[model samples]
Target: MTRSTDRWGVTGTVTATASATRAAAPDSATVAVTALGEAASAARARKRARNRAATVRTAIEATVEVGIETVDHRVTNSAVTFEPETDAAFRAVEEFHVRCEPDAVATVVVEATDGGGGVDHVQFALTDTARADLQAEAMTAAVDRARRKADRLAAADGLAVGAARSITTQPARPGNEPVDDAWESDPSVHPAPISVTERVEVEYELTAAETDMTVANDSGKG
Candidate 1:
């Protein structure tokens, strides 16, 4: 009887072990399904966030502004001809204005003699600072005019004009520098115009601050 009881107890222990192994298999499968569901949800959320960011980036890139340039110029000239014994005498008078302050000199001696035809010596000097001041004023005025024109253009194009980024002033190219036969024929008659020009380059930033056209309409109504 003792042997039979011991054999029954061993059989019960084996049966219990088999039941627990079968249960564990189903539990593991359930846990794997739950984990896979969580991973899929997380991936979908990440993709949505990336798409939103890409849309904003595209909008900003489209609203960037382009740069523009404006220019202004003014030119004037003076003539001086004298009966000097030699070319050297007229040249000396012209040289006098070289060291003199631009403000002090009114007349600019161009040449000592008209080499084209046997004429008396001539001298021409560019009036210094005082005359340049007048030209500078004219140039500044021209710049203002250009700015107005730019404003009108910006308005027409639906753009906003920003402050000037840079400004430059350059003398007009001298007519004498060009050896056109037409100009040489009457060098005295065709004196080079003294020129003062102003140029500016400006940068403007453009943006479509909101996607909703309603925002623009609200602003207008307000």
Candidate 2:
């Protein structure tokens, strides 16, 4: 009976040890939860670092601007013509055409007048080549003026004028385009001025030249 009692007591002790071991076992689920938390924390830190870097980059770049203006000169050349015609009633008509020959003339206009008698009037345009030559002359004059101006400016600044960088010319507007019916009915406006204008834009560079100078002293008293 003592042996049996001892055996039963030993068995009961073993069972209790097993139960304690089961209770102390770690939960795999809890391990996964701790790992997830660590991963989330690392991701948040990376995102914050990226955002800060972007902000720094944005603050590094900005800018300002400036502007400049220049002007050019032009000239206008013109000619006038008139005609008188006497018929049933002092009626006269004047007409003109653009001439390009003997001179470069544009905007030839025509007008009619009641001269109180019957009179016939006729007007012709100058040669086209002549008008074109005139226009060329006008452009030449403008270029000369521009060169002179550049020379003067350079002289004032103690610099030498260099070669022209660029040059451009534009045609002038015709005068006929400006006349209306109001001017057509009045004889006072009979000989409308025909004009052609030319514009020139020029650019020149400036340079400096070296020169030698000497000093001399003169004293009569000495």
Candidate 3:
């Protein structure tokens, strides 16, 4: 409920948030490169690690043959020093976000890294086309919710709901984080449902009921 102006031009504004969920499988996974060696061989190890990372990235992009939608990678270097400050070894780490089928995730990562690194995280998300559809539905639901609330408030006050004067919506928020590892226990298992939420604010005009207008006319006559 929101503000109103005059008695005959009452307004009912409602803000509502509505959610829609879609069952999704793990379509993407994150993998970390574990390439470390003594400082003496840091230069050589870094090269090999980069090569391995490159190979993994290529494999990920070529997974579906038509090419996966997302394949991102970043490289980082860190040094671990012992009690003797001089005794330190550098490590080259590369992480990738690979899009692939849930069932083939392990196989792809293992084969790509030659059984060196392991899967770090798995995520579930709707494809671009599906996401757009879901967002539309969610937004509609939010607006409907606001409308219902406004109607109820108007009815309680002996007023009829009228045309919408204004409407506004916020961007939808889609959840795509790695929720669980149930896929590890069962390859065919689907990921948890992903929810998208949309918020809307609507302003509706409130008009006096016909009975109320008739009563006012009778009073004026008396």
For candidate 1, write residues 23-63 as lDDT tens digits: 00000000000000111233443344334333432332243
- Model 2 misplacement above 4 A: 1-124, 170-195, 210-222
Q: Please report, as a residue range, the 10-residue window in candidate 3 with the lowest summed lDDT.
A: 65-74
Clashes of each: 16, 27, 0
Per-model TM-score on C-alpha atoms: 0.30, 0.32, 0.63
Error of 2 at 37 (Å): 99
Q: Write the per-residue lDDT of candidate 2 for residues 1-222, one digit (tens) a residue.
A: 001124212111000000000011111100000000111233443344334323322222111111111121111111112341211212112111111121111111111111111112222232345446545666676777777766676565444556766776644444412121212322233333333345566766554422211111222235
Q: Rank the candidates by lDDT, best first.
A: 3, 2, 1
Ranking by TM-score: 3, 2, 1
lDDT of 3 by residue, 80-156 (tens): 34453334344444555555555565556555456355455455455666556666777677777777887787777
Pitting candidate 2 against candidate 3, the one with the higher TM-score is 3
Local distance difference test scores for all models: 0.28, 0.30, 0.54
**Residue 91, model 2: Cα distance from true site in angstroms:** 20
Per-prediction CA RMSD (Å): 44.0, 50.5, 5.6
lDDT of 2 at 5: 22
